[model samples]
Structures are given as structure tokens and as C-alpha cells.
Target: MTQLKNLLGFLWYVAHKFQRDRCMQSASSLTTTTLFALVPLVTISINLFSLFPEFVKVSQAVRNFLLANMLPDSASRIIGVYMNQFSSHASQLTYAGLALLVITVFSLVITVDHTFNAIWGTAPRRSWPSRLLIYAVLILVGPLLLGLGLWGTSLVVSTSMGWAGEGAQATHSALKVLSLLILASGLALAYYKVPGRPVKGRHALLGGALAALVFELMKNGFTLFITHFSTYTLVYGAFAAFPIFLLWIHLS
Candidate 1:
């Protein structure tokens, strides 16, 4: 009971800090930046994987996993189609065009970095050259690691299903758990690394787990609201997904 009280107190304190930091406003700005950068970022990741023929399946699996876990069914379908089309065109860009693509993507990252530092009440700790190097390395390496992880996960799931003769439902449940864990880990990494000051790992993990839980609940609630309420669909018709996606990004 004492531990529970302490946990609640800590969470309340964090909530107040987030409010004071204007995180909602930050999220809104991030949503706008993300909307502009989404295609360029996806194009870069896709192009990176395209250099290696063997990882083609891995890239496809990663895309499917993201769509399945991150967005609602209808929104995911619409966005996936548009994203693929945009990325295809983006991949054909010339040197100058590709530089612009990188810049667009970098702008989003810089926004996130600034927001994080503001929340932490710290100035930027890294020089521009160092930051650029870090960003370039992340862009080059992050997707490769993610693809390998997902590929390994798929192999493990297949082996597990084969051994146990589990049905599709079990596989899906496993994937859902995997997605949650991955989200939590990513959040924790961000919380730990983005801040200029040192943060305790356990505290960061706690915050990440809490945030991930809230995010999962928000996703389900939002999906339910969209499923039951046809107001957006009625108003926007076929273009409802864009607004819904924007709303989700802001809320997230």
C-alpha cells in the first residue's frame, strides 16, 4: 500500500510537470512535423532496405507489423496505400531532391530533440556536427536492427506455432504482446537518451511502461470511438482517414 501510494504520487508529479511543459502543444507541433516528414522518412528506410535484396522480406514484415500495431484497420489501409505510393515516387528523386527529403526528415528529428530538451529543462548538449552524425547513424542503423528483430520474432513465432499447433488467434495475441513490449522499449530508450541530464534507468523504464500502457488504452478507446461514431466518416467521406490519423498522432 505504501509503495502504491508512492507510485501514484510520482505519477501525479510527472503529470504536473508534463502539463507545465506544455506537452500537448508539443505533440500538436510534432503531429504537423510528422505529417510533412512521414513520406520522406519512410522513403529513406525503404531505400536503405532496398540496397540489400535478402532483407526485402524483413522490410515488408516490418511495414506490416507497424500498420497492424500502430494504426486502426481502416486508417492503416488508407495510409499504407498512400505511403507506399509516396515512398515509391520519393525513391526516384535526384541528388538535390533526396537532400531535401533528408532535410525534411531531419527537421522532424530536431523538433523532437528540442521538445525533449525543453521538457528536461536543459539546453542542447550536443554540437550540430555530433547531432548530425548521431541522426545519420540512427537513420542508417535503426531500421536494419528493427528489421532483423522482427524477422527473428517471426521465425520464433512460426516455430512456436508449429511446435504447439496453435491457431492464428494465438499468433495474433503473441504479436500484440510483442508490439507492446517493443513500444515500451522504444519509449524508454527515448526517455533515457534524449534528455541532456542523466536519468535513472529504472525510472525511465517505469515512465516508458506507464506511457505505453496509456497509449495502448488510448489506441483502443480511439478505435472504439471511431468504430461506433460515424460522424467523421459522414463528414469527410473517403478522406476521413487523414483527419483521424492526424488526431491520433496529436493524441499520441
Candidate 2:
């Protein structure tokens, strides 16, 4: 009974920490950035789902959905155009989205670094020249960084494919293991480079790697828990992804 109570207390602490850690101070900017992120998120989510098998099963139904209840004719037409484009050559769209998403994410990453720096008492000199330099670097290098990150992911996936006979999930556990670290490295680069502070890449990389590991473990654990234990509405089932992803980012 004592152990159970302690565990519950720990979970509550984690939830509270998540709420506090989320970059809510930059909410308006974050929302705009998230909107920008949506294109890539959708692109990546669709591709990953098709590869993962779980999402491919419902893609047709999902497509049928937007086609049915679309509001304005113009909006519907745009969606139709997007869908057509999406189905024809997903890689092109994914690449485009990946390019855009990287810029958006790096912008946010810099903001996070600035905010954290300010809060942590090591705020950098943000003179006009330095600020301009930051903007220039962000605009020029952000997309390239994103492209490299995506290429790294593609390499892992390709390597996984050569080993697996049919299923795309045929990669070794080791490959799955390295993917998180690779992603963390990209994030660490962004975090370290974006900040005006003197944070070293090694420190940011370690922090990012730890955070990524916990986030992945927690995400999978929560998914398994929901699949095995909980039940929710039939109509609004798909939005579960929102809360899960949001919570992970918040907490992580």
C-alpha cells in the first residue's frame, strides 16, 4: 500500500512537471510554428503509418472522411489537390514538408533556448547585430539541417528494409535504438547553436539524448497502456494522437 501510494505520487509529480515544462510563454508563436509544423507532421505521419501497417489500414477511410464533410468548395478542392498530390508521390511532399518543418522547429528551438537561458541566469547579449546573425543562420541552415536529419532517418529505414523480408518494421532492435539517438543529435545541434548562451554541444547532446530516450519510452509505455486498459469514444478516437504527442513534448 505504501509503495502504491508512492508510485501514484511520482506519477502525479511527472504530470505536473510536464505542464510546467511546456513552452507556454511562447504560446502564440508556438501555435503559429505548430501550424507550420502540421504540414510536415502530416507528411511524416502518413508515410510512417503506411510503413508501420497500423495506419495504412485506415488511410482509405480517412480519405473518404475529408471528402465527405468538406465545407467550402474551394477548401474541398484544395484538399482534393493535396490528396491527389499526396497519393501520387509522397516523397516529394514529404521532402517539401520536411524542409519547411525544420525551419519552424529550429525557430522554436532558438526561442526555447533563449527562454531557458533567461530563466537560468545566463542570458546572452542580444544586440541587434547578434540577433540579425541568429536570424540569418536560422534561415540559411535550418532547412539544410532538417534535410540532413531526414536523410539520416531514411538511411536507418533503408538499412532496416534490406534485412527485413517483407514487413517494413523488419529492422533490428538496434536500429530502432539508434534512431532516437540520431534524432537527439540533430536536436542538440539546434539547441546548442541557436542559443546565445555558451552551452556546449556535448552538454546539449547529453540532455537531448536523455530527454529523447525518456520520451520514447514513455510514449510507447502509454500507448501500450491505453491499448490494453482504457476505452474511449468511438467518434473522437483519432484525436488521441494529439494529446499523446502534446503530452510527450510537454513533459519531455
Candidate 3:
């Protein structure tokens, strides 16, 4: 009972800190920024995926996984329309158009950097040149890495299926675990590196785990709400995804 009380007290303190930091305001700003950035980010990712024809299946798998996990059914169709619109135009983009896309994506990255710096109580955010270089690398490398992971998972599942007839369920469970681990690792790295000041590994790990756990619960809970009770469709009409995404970003 004492331990439970201590845990509750710690959580309350954390909630107070979060409220004092004005994270909801920052999240609102980020949601708007992300809405603008989404097309550019998707365009760039599609271009990246096009580079490796052999990983086409992996790219599709990742896309399907994300669509399944991230958006509720009511909002997914609207989100898909925008995604397809961006993807269709990616191949036709001229050099100048690509440059604009890069700038837009980087704007989102910079905003995130500022948010993390503020959370860490750091002053005078990193120079634009340095931030640009880092963000550029992340933008270019992250999707390729994700595709590779999905490809690897596919191979593992195939091999397991061939070796053991009953391995499909096990493979699916393993892949789910792998995906969670990947999410946790990315969160850990973000928490550790985004802050201007150096953060302890344990602190970063704890933060990352907490973030990932909350994200998972939120995703499931939000989906359940959408499935059973949400009247967002009626409220927002055909453009329901916009508001749903905005709310999800703030929740995240």
C-alpha cells in the first residue's frame, strides 16, 4: 500500500510538471506543423522506397502496418486519400519542388527539436546547420531502415513457416514484439539525443518505455472508442481525419 501510494504521488508530480510545461500548447502547434509536413514526408518516403525495387513488398507491408496501427477505421480512408495524392506526385516533382518539400519536412524537425530542448530546460537551441544535417540524415535513413526491418521480418516468418507448419502464429507474435522493440528504441534515442543537455541512459530508457507504453495503450483505446462510441464521422463529415489526427497528436 505504501509503494502504491508512492507510485501515485510520483505520477501526480509528473502530471503537474507536464501541465506546467504547457505541453498541450506545444502539441497543438506541432499538430498543425505536422499536418503541413505530412505530405512532404510521405512524398520523400515514397521516393526512398522506389530506390529499392526488391523491397517493394517491404514498403507495402510497412505502409499497411502503419495504417492499421495508427489511424482508426473512420479516419483511415481520409488519410489514405492524402497519402495517395502525395505519393502520386512524388515522381513528378522537379528539383525546386523537392527542395520545398525538404524545407517543409525540416521545419517539423526543428519544431520538435525546440520542444525537446524546452523540456530539458536548455537555452539557445542548436544551430540550424547542425540541426539540418542531423534531420536530413534521419529523413533519408529512417524509412530505409524501417523497410529493411520489415524485409528481415518477412524472411524470418517465411523460413519459420517452411521449417515448422505451425509457426505462423509464433511468427506473427514475434513480429509484433519486434515492432514494439523498434518503437521503444526509437523513443529512447529521441529522448536521449533531442535534449540539448546530455541525458542519462536510465532516465532516457524510462522515459522511452513510458512513452511507448502510453502510445500503445492510447492507440488501442482510441481505436476501441472509434469502433464503439465515437461519432466523429457525423461531426466532421468526410474530412474527419483532420480533426481526429489533430486530437491524436495532442494526446500523444
Candidate 4:
């Protein structure tokens, strides 16, 4: 009973902190920045996969996984088509154009760094060179890690299905769990590492898990709203996907 009270207290405190930090504004800013950076990021990911032929299948799987799990049925198809178009155009960029794309991507990272710093009440700790290196590593390695995770999860699911004769429902449940865990783990790492001050790992983990749970709930609620409501489709027509995508990014 005491532990439950403590947990409630902690949650209330975190909610207060989040409100005080103007996280909604930060999220709005992130959504705007993401709109500009999405194509470049996708292009980069596509280029990375191209360089590693063995991982091409993993990349495709990751895309499919995200579309199926993270997005609403209405938004996923339209967004996927837009992403493919943007990435194709981005891939043909000249060196100067590529540099601009990199800059645009860096702007998103800088915004994120500032947002985290604001939430933590800390100044930037890393120098520009170090920050650049870290950002580059994150941009290049993050998708690869996600692809590998998807690949591994697929392998496990396949093996399990073969051994246990599990049905599609079991496979989907496993994938959902994997997605939740991966989201939570990534959030935990960011919570631990992004702040200038030291954060306890357990605290970060707890916060991350809670946040991931909330995000999953939000995603489901948003999907349900979109599924039932055709207002956006009626109002925006073909461009409805853009706003829905932006709203999802902000909520996320």
C-alpha cells in the first residue's frame, strides 16, 4: 500500500515536471522539425541499407513493422507512399544538396538536444565536434540497430511458430511486446544519457517504461479516433495524411 502511494506520488511529480517544462510546445517544435527532416532521414537510412546488402531485407521488414504497428491504417498507406517518393528524390541529390540534407537533419537533432536540456535545466555539455560525432553515430547507427532488432524478432517468431505451431495471433502478440520493449529501452537510454546531469538507471528505466506505456495508449487512442472519424478526410481530402502524420509526431 505504501509502495503504491509512493508510485502515485512519483507519477504526479513527473506530470508536474512535464507540464512545467512546456513539453507540449517542445513536441510541437519537434513535429515541425521532423516534417523538414523526415525525407533526409529516410534517405540516409535507405543509403545505409544500400551499402549493406545483407541488411536490405531487414530494412524492408523494419518499414513493414513500423507501418503495421506504429501507424493508423488510413495514415500508414499514404505516409508510406509519400516517404518512398521523398526518399527517391532525396537519393538523387548532388553533393551540395546532400550537405543541405545533412544540415536539415542536424537541425532536428539540435532541437531535440535543446528540448532535453530545457527539461533537465542544464546547458549543453558537449563541444560542437563531440556533438557532431555523437549525432552522426546516432543517425547512422540507430536505424541499423532497429533493423537488426526486427530481423532478430522475426527469426525468433519464425522458429517459435515452427516449434510450437503457434498461430498468427501469437506472432502478432510477440511482435507487439517486442515493439513495446524496444520503445521503452530506447526511451530509457535517452532519459539516462541525454541530460547533462547524472540520472539513476533504475529511475530512468521506470520513467521510460511509464512513458512508453502512455505513448502506446496514446497511439491506440489516436488510431481509434482516426478510424471512426472521417472528418479529417472530408476536410483535408488527399492532404489529410500530412496533418495526421504531423499530429502523431507531436503526440509521440
The list of candidate 1 runs beyond 4 A from truth reads 1-12, 163-167
How would you encode candidate 4's per-residue C-alpha lDDT over 59-172 as one tens digit per residue?
A: 787777777767767667866887788767765789998888889999998899899989999987888899999989988888788878887877777776645557456767
For model 3, name the residue pairs that clash.
none
> For model 1, how does the per-residue alpha-carbon lDDT over 1-252 read when each residue is reduced to its tens digit?
999999999999989998999999999899999988876686577567866889887788777877888777766787688778877686578899888878999999999999999999998778999998988877777777776777777677777665555745566777788889888998999899888999899999998999889988988988899989979888899888888888888987
- Each candidate structure's count of clashing pairs: 0, 0, 0, 0
lDDT, each prediction: 0.83, 0.53, 0.77, 0.82
Model 1 scores what on Cα lDDT?
0.83
Show where candidate 4 strays beyond 4 Å. 1-15, 163-168
Q: Give the TM-score of each candidate.
A: 0.90, 0.48, 0.89, 0.88
lDDT of 3 by residue, 1-252 (tens): 999999999999989989989888889889888888966785577568766787677677667556655555645566677778888767888999888888889889889888888877895357868878888888877877876786688677868574664576766676677777777888999998888888899988888888878788888888788778758789988777677777776676
**Of 1 and 2, which scores higher on TM-score?**
1
Tens digits of per-residue lDDT for model 2 on 1-252?
Answer: 999999999999878764675546545455555444534433443444355454453444333332322112223344456656655675555666657656664565456556665444575657757766766565444434443444455446656564555334543343355556555775677567655567776888887887667656765665566567546425448565444444434443
Q: Could you arrange the candidates by lDDT from highest to lowest?
A: 1, 4, 3, 2
Instruction: Give the clashing pairs for model 2.
Output: none
By the lDDT metric, which is better: model 1 or model 2? Answer: 1
Q: What TM-score does prediction 2 earn?
A: 0.48
Scored against the true structure, residue 18 in model 2 reaches a CA lDDT of 49
